[model samples]
Target: MRRRFSLLALFAIATLPLLVVLAQTSDAPTCEIVAPDLGSYIGDWCAIWIRVDDPQGPQTVENVTLTVTTSPPKSKSFVYTTSRYNDTFFYANLSLPYGRLELTATAVDDSGLQGSHTIWVIHPFPVPYFNSFDTPTIHFFESWGEDLTNWTISPAGTWHVNYSNYHSPPSCFYTGPFSGPITITLVSPPINLTNWTGEAFLSFWSKINQTPSFTIPPTDYCCVEVSTDGRTWYLLSPYIVGYWSWSFFGRYSLTKYVGRIIYLRFKLVASSSGGGAGWWLDDIIVGNEKKVLVLDKLVKHFSCDSLDEWTYSGDWSVCTSTYHSYPSCICCGSFSGNKRYTITSPRISIPSVNDGQDIYLRLWWKFLIDQDCRVVVQLYYDGLWHSIGEFRSSLKRWRSSSFWITQTSGKRIKIRFMVEGYSNYASFQGLWFDDVTILVFNRRIATKGNITGWFSTENSLWRVTPIRCYSYNFSLWWGDTSTCLCYYGVSYPLDLWVDLRDVDHAYIHFHAYWNFTDPQSCASLRVCYDESEWVLLDTFMGARSSWTTRQYRINGGCVVRIRFQVEVYSSYAIGFFVDDFAVLPTTSDTASPNVSIVEPKSGAWFNFTNVTCVWQGEDDVGVCEYEVRVDGSSVAVELPPTTTNY
Candidate 1:
């Protein structure tokens, strides 16, 4: 009886249904459409979506045909079709001239099923090639001062830490590889003037003895030291010898433990080996340690469900049984035997709020079957989930998906996979995720209130004309150069007159309007900071079919004169128009008015101690007061019309 049962079990297993998957023999399918509602299709931008719905068969729906016609049977007719995607979307480019339009789709299939949808087309604006470099806002912090003397002098012209007597250059020196401790000190304030943290650097010139056996003691070469109270010191690290022509002058970095007044000290440890010799030191510098903000640090992971975070698996595409704790929902691997694949856990949570800026999402996935898969990522727009885009899986390889999340609002999002098997044995593996970043627009540095003077038109190319030839704050003359091509191949001729006070850097931004008169064309704008010599900052080419704003920065101060010359070398007619030329302050330059005594005050005076003096100050907006200085010193007492001071 046991042998008979075993035989029956084996037979049953062998009789199980054989699953078959077909290859995708066509391009990505078009959108499916729904029949028009009421008297006319209610919404414009209507679409017809389609996709292969059959399994164990050819996923390709060959020779698909679509016909769209208005209700009144007007001459206006538009037709388009999808070769594949059991569900494909189609729509008329410009809607029917009359009230309503009907759409029908038919494809060759064994099932012989037909699908149809009615849609209306509204005036569609050509999708802009979202340029992240639009309007160029730059967050360039101008270095306050240069390290004239290597003595790591900070912007305030002092060391980054506190120290002993620091007079001038010839005053600094180094002493012998001691029978005693060698002392090094500098006098100055902290590195970062504001709420700064972490370590800072202090540079000073030191001349070591050339004696071959001379070795600076390990303890003697300690990192520069810093202290808040001038006592209870802290050292950065042990010093290392730096290369030099005459002597070894090395710099060290020290952590700033104190703010405002800081003291720096370096002590030479007693060394018994490597030349018990001497050295000389001079020129000390102090500055804040450079800091960097990585793009990865600022990114926040998200899920459509109630989860706050996404899970990270040790292996790509393979998920653990457990979900992420911080971010509630995560991609869990649908495990079967040794097989593991990622799948969405239902009821996911969207984050409470988005980063509220332009962000990018990267997805890594693998399929374990011979099929084309799609991961539809939906964002909570308005009140429901709206599809932003989808991550698609190819025939044989694991594919990565990426898209920018431009929508700024709403929290929850939903992600689901659409799998169409060309063969039953489809699967993906070894998926990895990385390099996800959000780019914040930075263009202010190029277009802020740094204008000089003058405004003029440069030239006219491709219907672009600069009214004036002379260079000014708003415009400039770009030498005229012509191409034998008709109006279609006209170059971009643009002149800028920049008010030195109104703009500082020159950025070329313009839009080529595409209309019936002008079909397609390309042009470029060139700019140079010098009127006498021009350096081409950028040469914009490609479909000049839409408005585009571009910006570039050059190192200059006040009204740096520049020229913009346009050159077109295409035969295709293109229309070009440019405006919104702006030069704004790179950063928030709003500063508090500084009060200084400019008049009746020059130097320290002890002679006329009781003299009545008048003072004045200047500021960005306007001067508000006159201060009084007596004997090279300022007093809190207000100035009197005809008074005396003591």
Candidate 2:
């Protein structure tokens, strides 16, 4: 019987006492390995602690063991028993070579029921330098042996490193104050450039604050040089002129010297008698190539050979003639009587200051008048129409118009040419508009004096007379009246012009009353920047009467024209009255004055009585006087010039 016993039977007999002790418990023992988190790098020594528990009782757990398996072809396993107080703890003294190691801990109960947990640890080798200077001390190198006499590595020179000054943190090397003539070279540690096979670049942020009085000689300047071997060096960058502001210098390709280890050095040579502030460098990165994106300026020309970049409404036709530069030009308005036609160009995008440019529009136009027909140029921007200038061809000669587009930076805008005719009394030859072009100029030299005359109208000083007025009742805010009769099948178009040379915004307030029989009969109020096309502001149909106020924020153009048009198609319309038409221009007011009329609400009606008028006015500078107007008319009441209320 002793000769026939197997190896498995012998191992069971050897552990029979421990198995018998664990059989008293019902549940398996649980083990958890806590110390040395995943991906943790372990050096010479690492502490590992694990907790093992048995639901039956702590005494039911017999032993806890730890095993470490090292990764590689040399795969070796190290096993050890840990000491336990409440839980098991293992202080591992790792002796294997550096690599990845998997540590597993197992708890075996007295009944041979086991539970285990495993974790991976990484042990990485050290490198020389990839320093950002984010820590207290520099990690890589000490001072070089040869560079101490003329060049100093002190921080408190004429150029110092502070949080606001330096491109990166902590400190940077500086070389300055050589008294007379000196040439010094600052060297860097050897960088491995063999791995960078593709296009490689060395970039750094540098600032040089040379005194304005110090005149730098042509031969004496700072330059960058690279060295394959420590003894020989090649010039990498051009001589950089010393300036006061921090600027970026980069994209120096090292494609020629790709497969070699190299060293970068900065050579500073100064012959000037005056000692001045030197250069400061930070955030030196040597890596792959980097790309930067920028916006391009646009220039467009439409010869009108075809209608490729143009849109039209109503009747617009193109004619081929030698009157313009190109073979063809855009022509409109050949109708007999009462026709509205428009030709709209494609939208063009305006380059903003961020795109490093400014923009302008230019065009040539002419009109042929039989009775009362005009050609107008208008700009479409920010969902509104702006009148640039208006043209009526009494001589049928081509005229040119060019204006700087101000308020449309970083926006898309379009151009429109509108031709309108009112009477069919005679055979009329229409309007001609052609040769459109747009130009984009660089903002570097043109950006100065960006504050153009934003508010040209000072204290409502400028007033505009209506260019053309037709069948409408007109009464002054405080003066006389003109009357016209209501009639069907008639069209009335009133054109008013305002000079917006330096104006930024204009507020127009008026009282309007309209009574019409047909639902299609309407009174439309429109504005234009170039006066070539009309943009409708408000349209009133059927019967309506109210005091309406509208604000026009003007962009960069010289003139603004408004047109009030009333057309009755089938039935009678009466009392189309528009009064108290006021143009108030608030120029570029840096600080707005506070104004209040406490006595009456806006659009409030009053009767003849003993009424006390009160107002409150204040400004950051000082309120000069309160100009009180009753019913849109200034009352001639004597009061103090500095009076805040009436």
Please report the candidate that would top lDDT against the real structure. 2
TM-score of 2: 0.23
Model 1 stretches with alpha carbons more than 4 Å out = 1-222, 242-260, 274-283, 288-646
lDDT of each: 0.35, 0.55
> Candidate 1, overall lDDT?
0.35
Model 2, C-alpha of 621: deviation from truth (Å): 61
Q: At residue 109, what lDDT does model 2 achieve?
A: 78
Query: Number of clashes in every candidate structure?
Result: 131, 18
As a TM-score, model 1 comes out at 0.23
CA error at residue 148 for candidate 2, angstroms: 87
| lDDT for each residue of candidate 1 in 430-503, tens digit (9 for 90 to 100) | 23222222232211121211211122222332221222211111122222333323333444343332323333
Model 2, 84-185: lDDT tens per residue? 655434334444333566789888877788888898865532211011101111111122121222232323243333344454344454554543265656
In model 2, the runs with Cα more than 4 Å from the true position are: 1-298, 354-358, 423-428, 442-646
